[model samples]
Target: MPTLPHRLLHRLRLPALLLTAALSLPTAAAPATPAQRLADIATRAYDDQARFDPLSATGVGDHRFDDQLPLSHAPAERARRFAAWRGYLKELAGVPVAALSPADRLTRELLVRSLQDRLALAPFPEHLLPLEHMSAVPVQLAVWASGQGEQPLRTVAQHEAFLKRLAGLPAWCAQAQANLREGMRRGVVQSEPVVRALLPLLADLAQPDLARNPLAAAARALDTPPAGLPVADAARLAAAYRTEVAERSVPALQALHALLQGEYLAAAARRPGVGWGSLPQGAAWYRQLVRDQTTTALTPAQVHQLGLREVARIQAEITRVAPQLGFTGDPLRDGGLLAWTRTDPRFRPFKTEAEVLDAYRAIDARVTPQLPRLFGKRPTRPLDIRAEPEFTRATASDHYGLSEDDGRPAGVFWAVIPDPTAYSVVGMGALFLHEGQPGHHFHTALQLEMPLPEFRRRTWINAYGEGWALYAETLGHELGLYTDPVVYVGQLRAEISRAGRLVVDTGLHAQGWSRERAMAYWRDVTGAGAAQAANQIDRYLAWPGQALGYKVGALKIQELRRRAEQQLGAKFNLAAFHDQVLGEGSLPLAVLERRIDAWIATQRR
Candidate 1:
């Protein structure tokens, strides 16, 4: 929906190692109060964490590490990072929970739970499995070099730092290859499908054509002097890029291409080796993924069953919606109203990019006024819509991409209009609700503005984050965007897709459902076409338990809201309820539940 869990900075993987670091504390001679102790510890830990992960630090608005990307998978760096990891937990454990205010306690719990989860995953050597088809080193390189990502390219130093960053990549690949070799020896490798899926992307990056290479383009662009820069500095900068990125970096990418195609792919497992259950120590690993992703104790089996119930509930709503539009065919069928609406001329209204952008803006206009009644805080920037180049529009779905927080942009509501005539208007409003204003844009923007510690402000617990966005879709009714039968049905369909994920994700990983079976089930429940269903199933294969977070998180938030309304009766302020949920940035669902429970108790008192 709103581009995967990068809001949580999934790429910034924290390695769990065994070592120690001193937690910085208040320098005042007097003993710090519990609240002061927590603030100090969290602040110090957040600063250290930023320095530890340069890429993550860049994403989170810290520019100190803009030039350097550490060798995270290398043996020694992992050890030092873990030492800092332990210090975060150790410092927090020193704070007495009884003495701290609820707010500080909440931050403490978020940081501790985060560190503990990282600690728990220590047994799993994910570093060895670092190469992802979706957002691996190759993908990140393209993005940063294009000046669209967190890595700053404006300053002469930033440009130089980037060249240094590029120089580091070949070594990173070597380290990754070494780790993959170790994984191969240990019976831990990417599933064959994942390896194959990654090949094309890597091969493209390894292409020798400098014109087509974004990495090289970034370097060449430095040849032009900036407004105040000396001509001499520009020449040096351009030469650095030529030597480091062009001459050296380009060759390294080619080597990585050969290594993966020749060796790593050969080592990956065959068909149906998609899930973690197929890997070494797989069952436990899958379980840990479930725990870390959803922040719950629910097993895959339990999650699957919960998904079954949820799928049925959402499906029934979609079915009820069809009759209002004079469509009676079974929506559960692959060739029913769900597919018909997509191709139906009446629903495929937009004929140009301008039309599509206008529709999104209109949806925003209608929803914006209503949001003030629901919550107090909102993003400063109004949701902005931008259409991709005609050829770049690969899907009909629209999504929100969070800005790198460099003041250049905020959350963007991207309308992917591939052939506008082929794009359906049926679910457009629901898409807006999920990806626009009150959905991702509001939640993420508000989070950035939170006065909480850096870690808490930036935290993105999947269940809490994705759940809130999905739950926000239901606000369509309240916001008056879903009163139209088509829009309401669209909302149901969007939600049902997530519900289907709950079933299909667990089914594939835990129940041993084949790719064919998983795709079929996904289509049956969500009415996705064969190709769409297959693509989605493979995404689940790439990320097990991740799809579960959407529905699981939404259900939990819905439950908490119901509990609050029932308990508070007329005292329940929708704004207050919303404030409670969004006030502390995203939280683990369980921790969110506790906050809501405490809020209810306080209101009663």
Candidate 2:
């Protein structure tokens, strides 16, 4: 599973701010038409999304709704929200796109499509099985409260707001129980591994020791320590966690665990796959997800076929380079390349997490000088590397952080180091290239610095955002970074992992593959251990079709670059092409292609 960039939270919350900007745009000379009025209403609807999910808003740099948290598990509330969304969409359809400017028209289309997708996903009971290996409400809440991940926790007021937010945890936990009960009734519970994994998480959080607890860590960091507070207030909050763990969070987790152990686990089908084709309406839901993720009309079959071709092509490249790296025969079958890369002494574990971060910083120092050659615009903010917190490290992915409005918190590239030895140096270079110097850090930082509309700067299309990072992986060779054959192999291995995801994700959900089957396939192909493979599979189970984005997106981008190079011939400017891609902010692949094509035509002229 791909780790989301911290800045993405800010992007998700930008639609509302964009709505405000849309409203403030100077009115046309004439009185607004019905179409214009409808567009305004649609804009308002998009803005309303912020109110429904305030935590999401805060992530996007919008502090307007900082104090509110969404009630995601309440069915009645959700139904009412969806109904309002649908009504807005219906009303928006009456507006003529031709009446609005291009940007506003795109926003209208995206909003309508987003609403329709939400409506489509509503009936699936996804809310019931929301907590998974990839994300849990508890983890997200902790990050939100810590003032570490996009949320501001600097001032006394902010601290109080977080405590207020914490006070609602019991209610949220109860809602989660309600959702799980609903899932059990509908036979739509999470996988057994996920449920089992969650048990320990609950146990850890519910432990009597507040000082060591990740949940209480934030409160300790607050200006007014909970310990020094009025006894009743402190006792009340502490009791809430106690009751939350023992009564709500713990029992609910245990019951869910029992359901998985007793029924779902046994009945759990073999093979990990992607999509919802097995269940009723599963196929249609998956189709929608592919569309939403890729922003294209390509079918799952098309994506699967494309994955096959990509795997073959990438494997051939690997085979060609194997002998040069000291492999004697059939690299894929012998597993020489995989073994050498994974167990190489140079990739040994760091004694301390600081050493691990120092490695990333070293890569940045080496790569920054070369960035100006590849990219005309670079981020002004500094890049720092940090270790993921121990509690969530097991499930966290290597992520990049976004800068705040004040530019105080530099963008950070966080690598989750569960075990030091697992941080392979062979993989680190390419990973750094993708997440640090020329990948997310550069791309996202550039977006923030751009003068694009507020929404475009902050919002992202997965196809473009992930595609750009994937694109950066290939840029290493051009940027002169993947000098060692081992590093190159790491790049290929990364590609293979993404390609394999298409196969395994589809296999799990669509083709009824079990967890063991999926893990085995990943281990066999990527040489990832059982634990790592299990984590990846569970992530796919948690969020279907998300893993498919990397390769699918990367392929589209590679295709565009190839076409651009062929068309422009000697006139092609690599730097210019990169600028064209990054400068427009993130767009759906289709829109990106159109923008690129227009740029190409201008260059040809």
Candidate 3:
């Protein structure tokens, strides 16, 4: 670790000493006013977060800890995070909420919820079951190393900073292996199939060939050191980085792969038996996950039933589009139309990848003008559609990568078009709405643009972010783009998919449904293909109750809009309501509801 810089050592030492003394005293005894105390508390919380997960810190534009990657699953570090959460809650308890402005109270509420959630989820074996096919530490480190992500690889210092992180990978992997073994002992393990799926991916990550090994991609980034760096230093840094990856990182990942494929794979649950409830205390754990994920008090059963009702409701809506699509059958009752749309020739309009890419751009252009009607605040940042990077496009799913605040690599929505002819036109509009404009791009960019507190800005509420995206899909109707029958049904299918997650996620975990049973229910409700259903089911298995948030959050936002519209009547401005919902950046659903209710009352005047 680098020593404290000589010039600021004394200055930093004084504040560190002062902070130590002040933290020991009663928080109420602090000299700052309540508002100042809250601000300090928020700042402290964010700093603690940055320190604990430095990669995330770098991802969010805080470079102070860019050089480090915490072995968070390690015992001492885990305990420290737990202690920090408890400590934050205790400090927050001292804040006099009544004395603060409504805004600060909301801040307090969000912070409290966020901290409490950490504590609530701390007891779960999520840390034990860390590695997944989608993402974990390995994928993250690879993404950062590729130089396409948030961490800068341009300057000599930046390159060295990442080198430090690369050096830490082996230790983190060792700890991760221990945790996985512990999970196997405690009956907290991933499915055999998921593990099997992940084995090859990890192998690819640890491959001997630099072209195939994702982690080694970091070395290529080091090939271009900042221009001013001395040639000797640059070459040295590049060699050190490649050596670190080849010597330390790849071997560590290989060890993990060997462990998982050998013993962990043997110990893993079979497909039908993979539900969380099969584990000890898993029922209650699933409930806690529900509470944590949805940010509401709804039980797993309630979510399941809500999913059922929504499936029926959306199925009814799907029937109305039958005439336009020429779909024949009682799809409204049993979803024949959904299956029909998939096979319908008209839906497969794209013959080339270029056509599919241009269609998305065209949709963005068409929807650009109508945005003013429903949103008072739109993102000032430019968002464009692009194919995923050539390296990962074949495997990566459709996703939106937020632009750096500096704007060197512009924000882009990456469309994963493995086969253009296979891309369905029916879902394109709603997909664009969710992943591109007025969804993630809008939600994320607006937060960066706003002058919110750093902690709040970076502290993404998954429910809010995803729910807002789901909610954003519906805005297509008001934006005048869903006039196409195919697009309208596409929107409904997307909603059904989210709704199906509610049932299937809760069913698999809480209702004791088998993987096959979950997939069956999912298809019956959403009319999704078998592959799609299996993929979605596996995802929920990887992260319980996480999928629950999409629909739950969107429902809450829609409910708040209804509440606001009912209260304000003809005076209600959708743009204003949307602004209120998004103006504070991402929020827990309950905190978001409070903000909306307050907005409703204020508008009553």
Candidate 4:
């Protein structure tokens, strides 16, 4: 629970020192220049980013900032942050890129450009609709209260800290109302279906049964009774749900529901696209987001086109294996492939969640020996598998979790197992490869172990991180993990899933496609059933451009690897190439390519 500045500076110190040292070393050639100074400033800029978003720090295993949260809602606070960003940009403009090392230069350019882009978005009324279907005040409260995710519920002090957090629910709901009101005035409202989803979620929170309520469950777990405190303390910690839900949260929901019903829903744009194009300056904002997220200057049209090409390539691969899985007739016609996979008995009945986890664990065991063949370095932290929590599992995907403060908990691959019958063994092996072993678990854990700056460790560029995982899916053959054709199909299906995302995500937001249209696209393209298709579309709607990052990133990484292999020919070392890709920490794809090209040149020597 450190202050924002403290948390931000703490994570930056190590990297700053290392970077300074690197720059000061007598080059035996010449003195440093303005560009080098700018690179140094950009590193500081990244430090500022780490501070502004502490949750991001936790994900990167920098626990120094775990207690702080951004208050982006306050106008004064927003102004202060904006001023700071403007100062950083001004400093960046003074230095040139040519004087810095390639790595530092890229960091400087990206940091400045991203900051400018973000400032451009500052005028938009995003704060009004900050809490949406993807994330909201209530959902975050549930996550923090559950004591299972990022918020540690371990010690007495930690427990009390949570109680204090819970006490602020009523005020948070009020803030949400104010924000939503602002959004309404500005015409930046959510779609009807998203607003409709909130009613049931809020009603569940407002339930009278304390046992079933997540807040009450946490309060009851405390060693001391929270009910017998001072009037003010007791009132604060006690169930504000009754008053908040009835007065604020529920009414806000109703207001939002009405807005959607009366205004936004009827006028809701039908294109099932994922971008800011629907709002004022949306096209420019989306272009900037594409640049920021991918860490490359690729346009939306370029990304959209890349998605098409990758989808075709992967579909051809899928066709190669579909027949071997005992499928007859065309795989893409008449729902044949979907029917076959969904009804296949080999894919059903796990009997228990443990069985599902064990299946992933077993894949972890099998994939260990192949690691040294493809990766010279491996993660010290172990990997585990578990079931995702039930409440959010409906919209959640299988995800990877980083280690705890002490690193004892180990990284985990959590499979969302709402019903065992829905589990498809056809894809489990590939899923394990991507989310569990040799994929996210290995990539993320090892990155945490690097000696990079704290800011670099905690920072994320979705394209490189997720793209590497998708590229890892392609490594199953190289790593000897896809011996089974069914599992091979699983890997293909996983790729298909990413490729399918490009079609549906853009279709929904950019193309004016309806929810049904998007869902049908996923079903037709990937052969995922109605339920799976619906969940995926809902996920995209909640998270807009996020889904596009996976396939987009994966394709870039795959492309880079192919380019390196083609150039290196017989001298190309797979293990060395992977080591180089990861050694630089999570970098923008452009930076990553430069690093790899350097490696390729050294090999040519």
RMSD of each: 3.6, 5.0, 6.3, 7.0
What C-alpha lDDT values do all the predictions have? 0.72, 0.66, 0.75, 0.62
Off by over 4 Å in 3: 1-29, 221-237, 270-272, 330-335, 351-354, 389-397, 405-410
Stretches > 4 Å off in candidate 4? 1-51, 64-70, 94-110, 220-276, 403-409
Model 2 spans with C-alpha error above 4 angstroms: 1-43, 145-147, 222-275, 278-280, 403-409, 452-454
User: Per-residue lDDT for 392 in model 1?
Assistant: 24
lDDT, candidate 4, equals: 0.62
Output the worst ten-in-a-row residue range by lDDT, candidate 3.
11-20
- Encode model 3's per-residue lDDT on 18-41: one tens digit a residue: 011112323555647888888888
Question: Once model 4 is optimally superposed onto the true structure by TM-score, how far is the C-alpha of residue 454 displaced, in angstroms?
Answer: 1.6
Residue pairs of candidate 1 with colliding backbone atoms: none
Model 2 agreement with the true structure over 1-605: per-residue lDDT tens digits: 01235423222211111121212222355236855575566545645666665555565566676655556557766666666677777777777778787767766665666667567666565566555544565666665544456666555455456556555556666666677666666656666666666656655665556566567655455435344346555445445444443454444445544554565544333313233565446777677777767778888877877777877787788888888688775677634476567876765766767788888788778888887788777779788777766777877777776535233756777788987756677788878877776778777778777774444555656777777887899988986667788778889988888888888877776677777888887887777867788778877766677777778777888888898999999999888888988877777788778878988888888
Q: Candidate 4's residue-wise lDDT over 229-340, tens digit each?
A: 4444443444543343345444544554455445444433442333346655566655665665566677777777777887789777767777887888787664456546
Clashes of 4: 14
Error of 1 at 434 (Å): 2.0
Q: Looking at candidate 2, what is the lDDT of residue 87?
A: 78
User: Could you tell me the lDDT of residue 349 within candidate 2?
Assistant: 60
lDDT of 1 by residue, 292-339 (tens): 778899999999888889877876776777888989778667736677
Model 3: which residue pairs collide?
331-336
